[model samples]
Structure formats: C-alpha cells, structure tokens
Target chain A: MERMDLEALNNELLDAVLEKGSLSFVVNRLHQALNKGVLICDCLGRILIGSNSEIEYDIDAYIAKAIDHSEAYYYDQEICQLFFPIGWGKLIAIIIVREVKEEEIENILPVLETANLSLCFYFSKYNAIREVENKYKDLFIQDLLFNNILENEEILAKSKLWGWDFKKEYFVAVIEPDNFINIKTFAEELEYITKKLAKENDIEIITSVRSGTFIVISREKNNQKERVKEMIVEKISRANKYFSEKYDTTFSIGVGHTYLAYKEIYKSYQEAKTALAIARLIGETKFVKYFGTLGIFKLLYKQEAYLLKEYYYETLHKLIEFDKNNNGELLPTLDALISNNMDIKLTAEALFIHVNTLRYRIRKIEEILRIDLSKLENVVNLFVALKIKALLKLHYSDID
Target chain B: MGYGFLFNIDACIGCQACAAACAKKNDFFLGFRRVQKYELKYRGKNVVFYYSNSCNHCENPECLRRCPERLYFKRRDGIVIHKMGECRACLTCLKACPYQAPKFNHQIGKVSKCNLCVDETGDPLQPKCVKACPTFALQLVHEDYYQPMAQYYHLPIDTIGKSHITQPSIKIIIPPELQKNGEN
Candidate 1:
C-alpha cells in the first residue's frame, strides 16, 4: 500500500473512532486490524460480533466450546477464538480462538485498546456537555418554580407568572415506597404504567413531572373531578393489589387535587401527601385521595364556625360522656350531622341509622344544650362544633 | 454495642461524592467499599436518591460468625474490624453479611471491610463515608442514643433489629413521611 493510501485509511479509522465511539467502534477497529476476519466472542465461546456467518454460540455455549489453550483451534471445518475480558467475570464477553498467529492477536489488541480509549474520550466529552446542560436546567427550574421561598415576600410579589387556566385541572400523586433502596427497575415500571394510562386515555397530560411526587396535570371540568378522582382511586387500588401480591407488602399512594397555579400546586401536593399519612393512620390499604373525601373531617374543616369558635370541643366532650354513660346513639348522630350537613335524610342513609333515631338524638342534644337543634342554621353550627371538638382531640393526641 | 452511620435518604442528592470519597479513603481496590449510595423507587416517580452503606458492626456480626480464620473482631464501641493479614481468602464471610459489608481484594488476596479509618494516623473516629458525605447522609452516631433519637421523631424503632443478621448498631434517620409513604 502507498504511504498516502495508508494515511487516508488512518484518517478514516480515526474519524470512525471519534464519531461512532463505542463497542461497535472497537469491533470495527479490530476487524480492520484482523483483515476483517476476526470474530469477537464472549467467555462462553458465543460469537459477539464476527465475519463468520455460520458460527453459532451463546454466551454460555462460547465458554463451553472455546479452546482452553491460547493456540488456534479448528473444529468441524470451522475456526473459533476464546479469551476472557478484563475487570469482569467468567460468564462475560466472548473470546475468538481462530487460526490466528500470536503476532496477529498481539497487534490487534493495541488497535482495539486505542479504539476503546478514543471512545472513552468521546463519552467523557459528551458527558461533560450533558452535565453542564443538566446543571443549568436544574438551576433554571428551581429558580422558576421555587423563587418564592418562605420569607421572600418581596420576590414573591414581583414574581408574575401567568395564572393557570382554571378550565384545566391538575392532580399531584406521591409514590412512596417502604424500602427505597436499590430499586431503579421499579421506578421504570411505574413510569411505564403512567405513560401507558395517559396514552390510552387520549388526554394530553400536561406537567407530567417527576420529582418527589409524580405530578400529572390532566384536563378536568368541575363536574368531572369526581369521575377523574374515582378513576385514579381505582387505578391505584388495582396497582396496589398487584404490587402487594407480587412483593408481599402494601404500597401507599398519596393523591392531591389539581390546582390552577404552580403556587397552589405545591399546597395540593402537600395536602395529598398529608392525606396519605392520615390514610395510613386509619390503616387504609393501597391508596389515599385527598380533598375529595374526608368524610366528616371535610365538612368540619369547611365550616366557618368551627374555625372561629370553640363550641365544637365542648359539644364533643359532652357526647363522649354521654357515650360512656351507655349512650352509643349520639356519636352516630354527630357523624350523621356532619355527613349530611345537618340534613336528616342524607345523614340517616349515610349512617344506616334510623331517621327517627337521628331526630331523637338531635332533640336530646338540643334539650341538653338548651338550644333548638331543629333549626337549619343551628344544626349546621352543631355539626361544625363536633368536628372542631374531634380535631382538637386528634391534634393534641398526636402532639403527645 | 458500636455506634454506626445514618443516611438521610431525603437529603441525599445522589451526587456519589461519598462513594468517591469512600474509594479514595479506603484506597479500595476494584469493587471494594467502606461506603456507597443506594437508591429505590416510590410510587411511580423517579425519586433519585442515595444512602451510605457500611458494616453495621452488628450485635452479632455475620462476618465474625462465618470467618473461617476467626479474624473478625468486635470492638468495645460496636465496630466490627478485621485484620487483613489473617484472612485466608475464603469468601464465607462475604456470603454471610446480609448487607454485603465485606468485599474481596483480589490484589491483596484477603478480605477487607471498612476499618473506620482507625489505622490512619491522627484521624477522628469516623468512617470515610461519614466524613465525605456532602449532604450529611452518613453520620457515625453512638449506638445507644441513635435509637431513641430516631424514636423521638416518631420514626421506626427497630430498623436493624428486624434484619436478624448481625445486629449492626447503625441506623438510618429518613423523613418520617418516607416510611409512611413507601419504604420497605
């Protein structure tokens, strides 16, 4: 070969090394060194990549069939190679034991090393670029999303992001695992399931961000929030059952309602997460949806009198005393009052208690307190009072 | 009882600074570790995180029980240390560690575990992992006090107790919410 021709070939090889820098590049470089007849086999004598089309071997098979000695081995009118790769184990990449001289194998090893080194350089350069880009992106997002940190009132006031379209709804769901140690495969599985569900629904899920929580932004009308919530509850239930059966541990899900602005998004996320905690406290299995159903707690928190007055605590205390006095009827009445928002029929159906019994309990409480519980506004007040009472006890108990 | 390290999983950003520091601190040959970060998934989100792993210096060290040469020894402070010179390269101790604490050194032809940097001159009584953890994910706590410290915050009391292997005195103080959410 002419000197110019060899130089041109070198340049081409160098270009290949720089551009397609990976295992394939090493294979190509080795092929060039071996006059394109080299076969790369794993330790198991299975041909990894090769020029020989007829050779058949798996990783384990390659280990079994490859010649033990360094010398070339020919069997059944075919040539093969075998050698172990460094920094790995017995069942790793294949070695080619072919009709090659000692000088040829030694010469090709350097070329293969050079190709691998060149590839490593390329990867490092790519990784450096990636690292800078990721750092900038993370910084940008953190500044954009959380610039309004606590006590940064002036910064928060100046931060003018557009209001989210209230027409579109969002939900925050946190996936927490008990032992989040060395479980990357499980995360991939979850992402797969979420993507699949979103695709099947034909809904363009906005804000499908993954942080501590997998916050999915879905479009929901005010009327459709219930339906969407139910769907999520069902999905989580199914997933938990499947996971539990497979892993023998219950997986908890904390789901928050969608908000209009990014600011409210964090609150919703926290609320959903807190709801998950409450669910666990109650020993509810599988999943917990926040803000959608808090039973009596929802109404209790919703009422103004409960927020402003301390009457609820007193009312609950009295009811507890009555219950201890062998009166189990008042507790159900209190639950009914809150569940139905002081409505008799709804409360009766919700508790599965008799409406007459509910009426009698309310009348008895009215007589005890010297207040007319029959009045609509008074009934509402009493319901709120009971919730405040229960909440205080729970909060104090938790503190202790 | 020996005090061990704690990993705050929430604070661990998975930078691998601790792992690199561990490798450098121990002068670890290929694949050996005094400490390293671990990760897991929660719900469906990629909660990218890490934790420091090391010898728990168990109440009952599996490595000690399984050591053929009986080279593994427990100190008064709950550290499980070994003399590399005495090891016969028999890998039974590696198999016995539930946490996989001990690593084989092919170059030295002996087994190695985190020495708590005791051999190093003028060193504080701390492992390379705790000293190097940028996010304070790893900390060498006094064994007796760490349990009550965790229990004070309503966290689980029996982390190492449930393992039933060598009762390594080390424990992790993760976000209380994390265990409630999804921690196995």
Candidate 2:
C-alpha cells in the first residue's frame, strides 16, 4: 500500500481527540482506512479497528488456537506484541509484503506522532482518575472498618439519601462464577450488567473487588427487601438467559438475609458467599438463589451447623490419633480411610494393610466411642460428620 | 548507577521548558507533560514548585509489583526501566503509584515514564529534566555523594519510606527565597 496520507491522518486523529473526546475512535478509523490487510486491536485485546482480507476477526477463535499451539506461535504475528507492549509503546504489525522505503516511514511520521499523542493523553487521564478513585475507596473501606464511627446510626442516617433508620434493611447478593470460567471476563460482565440494572432502578451501584461481586440493595422499608430481591433475581435470570443464548454458560447468584446497617454488611457478604457455594454444589445452568438452597447439611449433621463440624473433627482427629499411636502407618491409613469410604477391609487393601489390623483399628474406634462400626448407617453418618467437622473448623479460620 | 531525577520547587519559574524539551527529545505526544511543574501553596505561601518528576526508580517500586505484564526493570545503578514490548497497558501499576509517575498513551494501552534518557541518543548522563531546566533546578548528580546532598536539602526526597525509598542519583535544588537569608 502507498504510504498513508500522513497530514490527513494527523488532522483526523487531532480532531477526534478534541471533538469526539476519544482516541480509539480516530485510531480505529485510521486503521480502517489503511486497507493493508492489517488487523488492528486495542489494548484490551478487543479488535478496535482492522483492514479486511480473507481472514475474519475472531478473538475467541484466536485465543483457542493459541491454547492449542502451546504459547509458541507468539512470534509468528506482529499483533502478538499486543499481549505485552512495554510502557506506552505501540506494536506495529508488518506483513512481509514489501520492503517499504525509508521515505514512506518518514511520510507517516506525522500521523504516527499524532496517534501516539492521542493514545498518551487517554492513558494518562485514565490512570490518574483510576488512581484517585482506588485511593479513595481504600481510604473509605479502611475507615469504615477501623474507625467504628459508622456504628453511630444517627450520623450514618443523616448521610443517607433517605435518613438513616435502623428499621432500614439491605439485602446482600454475592455473585460467583464457576471454576471453569475466566474470572476477569465474568467479573467485568457482571459489573457491567449490575451497573445497567442499577441505572434502570436509578441507584448508583457501589462495587469493589473484595473476593467476588458483593451487591447491597438498600431498602428503607422492611417489606421492600423481598421485592428488591425478586427484582434482582429477575434481572439475573434475564442476564443468564442472554448469556446462555450468546455464550452457552450458566450463572449462579446467592442472596443473604436483610441487615440493618453497613456494620453488618460483612456478615451478609459471608452468608451470600456460603449460599453461592451451596448453589455450586447444586449446579445447573441457570441462576439459583442460595439463601435456603441446601437441605443436605441439615439432614447429614443431625444438629444444625454441627454436621460440618463433626465431619472434620472425626476424620482429622482420627488421622492425628492414628498417626500418634502408630507413627509410620498414619498417612497410608488416613489415605485409605478417605478413599475407601471408611470400610475396614477396603481401607486395609488401599493401605496395603492386613484386614485384621484394619478391624483392630475399627475395634479401637468403637472402644473410643462405644459405637458399632458394622452398621451402614454408622459409616454413612461418620463420613458426613467428619466433613461437617472440618467445615466448621474452617468457617472461623478462613480469611479472605 | 541507574537513572536519576531532580525537582527544585524554588528555582522553577514554571515556564514548562523542561516539559517541552522532554516532548521534543522523545518525540512524545504534545501536551503530555512527563516533567510537570505543579504550582501549589505550602503553608499559605505561594510556592512556585516544579516536579521535574517522572519515574523515581524507587527501591520498593509499586509500579513493579502491581504491573500485570511485569515489564519493569530496576538496573543495579537504580534506573527503573520498562520493556514496552511486554506492556499490555492495563494501568494497574499506574493506579497503584502514590506519586503519579507513569504516563499513559491512550491511542495504545502502553505507559511511559522518564528513563533519564539512558537509552535515548542524547548525553546519557543528562535527562530531559536537567537539559531543559534553564534555572539549573534539576540535575542528574552522581550517586556516591548526591543522594546525601538531596536529603539534607529537603528537595522532595524520593528515597523515603512508603513513597519512593530508592535513592535516585540526582539532586534538585530550589533557589533560596528572594527575601530569605539564603538568597543569592
């Protein structure tokens, strides 16, 4: 292709930044005009602009192909540098079609320079604003946690749009993506959707990356909590429906009980996360409400919240005791117990132990608890008991 | 050993000469001031200050830590350089910095900072800040002695905790106040 009309490109870019208040639009326009069979992508790996040829722009397909090629094909394309452009450097993709003369390079210098300027302005402005916003968020959250000044309902109420009243309640919804999904994409999409939903409701959505999506829907009246929750569920269902149609993925949402003020927000966040976890276990493609999702824990534990606690304590405790009594044999025994459904004979074979010795240990366990191990109910009960025990221990211990 | 920086609030007339020189030398985007002169009041007195500031090449650099591309490098001599080839222009490092040091190019997602002209064609020892400062406010001093001199002068020391603890090998001198005793 002949050298791009540098003056025209420069004028176009300058006008774009000044008039449209954007640099990407102008750069994309330039790339579209070049018609050099070059594909131009923005910083985010999104195809901002490109010149058409036999090849079509499919970022997902490219990503999948890269995955198949084992990260070695990075050198084959000029656009590969888009993965990492050192501080403020533009990556130029040169197709080996022609040994473009130095004069041509010089000809496009003005356009390149102007494009460079516009890019710099946008980047600097974005970073400056983001820095300020993050700094303020950090300060605000830290203040809320350490200061205890938010505890004064009267003061907090005055700051609220509708005066602070303890009678006011907020429902917390925590959104979690499945393990197989891309975390950043999911988070960004969820944020966009939440913002859109908030805008429709005329409420500004305040979000932070403190784990996953922790959304607080403020309601002044007690009766409104359920109504807001229904709205949230309806919105999420619509979002999931759209996503399934577009990308073939399901979304799960966990909701928490209403809390009076911001002080109890952390607790609500935790509950929502737990609900999300339960929803994961009951996995399907649609959005599942987590508040009362699981009945398995109640049935398995006998006592509410005790099932998880007992399950961990018994399994771990048995391992520790077995390890202490027979120092060398505990690892194999623990492994056997976990893998073999705590069946004495099966566990013995898994551990390469004699059935008699496994039986002896079962006898020792019976002696410790005076409970019979021969029954299937006891074995099933013990397994769940051990799991719950472990969970309860982790409930207090898990940080972040 | 690495790149250095200098900022003299007192000597800065805020003519934007250093900034213009930087842009010219790097052929960088216009109106993007890598070396900015900030005029603000300190203790109610009109303090004419210039931050001939860009990258501090800090000891515990926040930009290095938060950068997703991990493109930044700290030379043994203390110059914090970035390999733009690896930059995705995510700007996480830019947000993490307390002193707005990283310059962003919006057309592309890349970021740039003052490299003290180490890799550029000009005199390697003189950064654009020092070259452009007509009042001699910014200077790229030798590390062996200049660092201590900078600390003693209270010249916007970059080698302090939680800010930029690395001792960049330069000293920025603010001229004594016109009516103050140290005036020349």
Best by TM-score: 2
Residue range A147-171, candidate 2, lDDT tens digits: 2232456436533633334344565
lDDT of 2: 0.51
Model 2 residue B164 lDDT score:
17
Per-residue lDDT of A154 in model 1: 31
Q: What ranges in model 2 sit over 4 Å off?
A: A1-8, A11-20, A23-58, A62-116, A138-148, A151-169, A175-190, A196-204, A211-254, A260-266, A273-400, B1-184
Model 2 chain A: weakest 10-residue lDDT segment is: A91-100
Best by lDDT: 1
